[model samples]
Target: MNWQSIKEQLITFLKDEVKKTGLTKVTVGLSGGLDSAVVSVLCKEAFGENLKCVLLPSQYSSDGSIEHAKEVCEKFDISYEIVEIAPLVNAYLPNMEHNKLRIGNFSARMRMSVLYDISARDSSLVVGTSNKSELLLGYGTIFGDIACAINPIGELYKSDEFDFARFLEIPESILNKKPSADLWEGQSDEEELGYSYKELDDALKLLVDEKRTKEDLVKFGFNSELIELIDYRIKSNAFKGKLPTIAKIQWS
Candidate 1:
């Protein structure tokens, strides 16, 4: 996929985007996943010491995930801070039912809140970590992980992240690990999507990039149900990518 070329382009994109914002620094949420690992390296290369990595872990976050997040920061020599969010989450969850899905979504929003606050404190932008696969499948919390001032990796699919992350010299421990949001205990991305990223990304490319129809997908030996499933996700979750709607009013 010519990852080296894309790497250079993304770095340049990061620099240019931040420059346009008159901000020299950016804060990224490192989730100990392939996407964040790759984005952190890119931000580090682009902004150097100006890059800040915030580790927002809750009780559901695994020991390995925390260690992996710290590993990336240490390996890259990037500046970072760990913010434990158990208290904040616990403070609110006591009033609601203890549903993992709800808790996970709430955790994601809380993480985003902290990231934005850090960015405000440092006068930096929030660089998002969601890849194309997740974005397309609507696999993220609105106004949460999807929120960012600029994203260098948004267009890169999850399927390509492993190879791209490896090219970026991401830790093998991170690259080899299964993809999870660490939102709740034992929450897996693929499991939630009901399909592996490769399966999803491949179909997404055909469905989104190639503009192929369901009939064509079926002709290519792709199951109609999988195509339909992907289609529904794209249609349903499409709202996550947009800004809030504002009604027009003439006051003059």
Candidate 2:
């Protein structure tokens, strides 16, 4: 919330993370969305010119998103590259059965794969762009955008993330734009989730983080059926947050 203090801490946080991983630079996938924009700026403040922004776009990616990503990178003097993943994704689609969900998942994974490749080439860690709202609501792909060497904004909610964006003085264009994963054409994150962030975060605060039950949520003005639905989603997707489960045997 405090820009002065958060700025100081972020610089130190990024420095420590880079040191721990023995990387002098950091890379982030800039989606032209608020979360990635915030991450890019934070990494810039921390790592300076050592931060690189990669725009891994596919056919579903909008031109507006790409231009905005480039604009932000230029503003901060961070190096950037726009890599089109459409060809790569299309090349692989033929060999695999394709569906909307499958293609969406593939898009996420392909973006990650490109990021890791660049990370290895540049000796930088891939910085994550997920926020608390997305993480708690199971709104991200497991090993895709969800994967990162270190995340500075993952703890902030979608609303809180926008607060930090203002603190970092992000461009209004990015700030005011709709939130999207850009995995498919014309897909907005909120539209897909069937709720706005304001509503979702409020519910998540009571339901997931606060450990409230359906009745408790109903008391807090949430619909009983909706609470149950959210509860089911969170529990069912809990596996995504954990490392692969392993079977254990009784030991002597």
Candidate 3:
């Protein structure tokens, strides 16, 4: 997939976009996941010493997550900060029982809130790490993981990210781990989505990039229900991918 060319272009994109903002520094929420890991590498290549990664973990975050995130920062020699979000989450959601989804989403938002604040304090832009696969599937929380001043990896699919990640020599431990948002204990992207990234990426490539119809996808041997679910997710969460709606006034 010409990863070399793609990597070069992404680095250039990050540099150019941040330049437009008149900011020399940038921040990323490094979660020890594939997408964030790859984005951190790209940012390190682009911003070098100007980049700072913030590790915002909550009570639900596993110890391995913090270790994995720190590995990326130390290995790359990138500056990083660790901030726990459990206190913030517990302060507000103390009684919000059993609804792990709500807890997870709130945790994501809290992390982002801290990230944006850090970026402001450091005079840096927030770099987004969401991949095309997750964005298309509406797998991220709005104003949370999905928010960023610039996204270098937004176009790359999750499956393709593995290749790019390998190209950049991300830690094998990170590359080998299952995809998770790390919002709660035992949370998994595939388990919740009911499909592996490869399966989802292949279908999205056909449906979005190739603009194939659901019927055509079925003919192409995709499960009808899978195709249906994909279409529904894209339509339902389409708002998350866009700017907020505004009411128009007709005063000429």
Candidate 4:
């Protein structure tokens, strides 16, 4: 995929986008995962000392996640801050009958809320870490991890994100770990999605990028069940990729 060339372009995009916003600095929520790590390195290359990595861990965050986030910051010699959002989340959703998904979504929003506030305080923009696969399938929390001023990796698939992360020499610990939002203990992204990113990304390429039909996908030996699931996800979650819909009314 010519990761080196792509990486250079993303770095340029980051720098140019931040400048367009009249902001010289950027803040990212480092989740101790491949996507955030890749974005961190790219922003570091783009903004140098102007990039700030904020680790917003909730109660569900793993200890290893926090440590790995710190390692990335230290490895890149980038500025960082650790803000615990558990207290804030608890205060907001206390005494509620929320399930894992609900609590997880709330936590995601809380973390993003902190990131935006930090961006305002630091006079920086929020650089997103969501990859194309997640965005395509609507696998992220709306107005949460999906919120950002500029997304350098949103166009790359999950598999491509890992490839780019490795090219950037992200810590092996992060690259090797199972992908997760760290929304709760014992939670894994693939487990929740019921498919590995490789499988999903492969299908996505055929369906979205190549504009293949269901019949064509079946001819390619793709499972009908998986195809339907992926198709539904793409259609249903398409809203996550667009602006809010508004109805137009005739004026007198």
Which candidate achieves the best lDDT against the true structure?
Answer: 3
User: Between 1 and 3, whose lDDT is larger?
Assistant: 3
Order of candidates by lDDT, top first? Answer: 3, 4, 1, 2
Name the runs in model 3 displaced over 4 angstroms: none
Candidate 1 lowest-lDDT run of ten: 94-103
> Which lDDT tens digits does candidate 2 get at residues 1-100?
5867876786688889889977699999998889998888888878888988999889878878898898898888889998899998998787667676
Q: Compare candidates 1 and 2 on lDDT and give the better one.
A: 1
After superposing candidate 1, which stretches have Cα over 4 Å from the reference? 250-252
Candidate 3 local lDDT, 1-252, one digit each (tens): 899999899999999999998999999999999998999999999989999999999999988899999999989999999998989999989677868999999999999999999998999999999999999989999999999999988899998889889999999999999999998999999999999999888999999999999999999999888899899999999999999999999998
lDDT against the true structure, per candidate, is: 0.90, 0.84, 0.93, 0.91
TM-score against truth, every candidate: 0.97, 0.93, 0.98, 0.98
TM-score of 3: 0.98
lDDT of 3 at 212: 90
Candidate 2 vs 4: which has more TM-score: 4
* Residue 224 accuracy (lDDT) in model 1: 79
- Residue-level lDDT tens digits of model 4 in 1-252: 898899899988988888888879999999898899999999999889999899988888999999999999999998999899989988977555767888999999999999999999999899998999999999999999999988998889998777778889999999888999999998999998888999888999998899999889999998888899898998999999899999999999
Cα error, residue 177 of model 1, in Å, equals 0.8
Candidate 3 local Cα displacement, residue 179, angstroms: 0.1
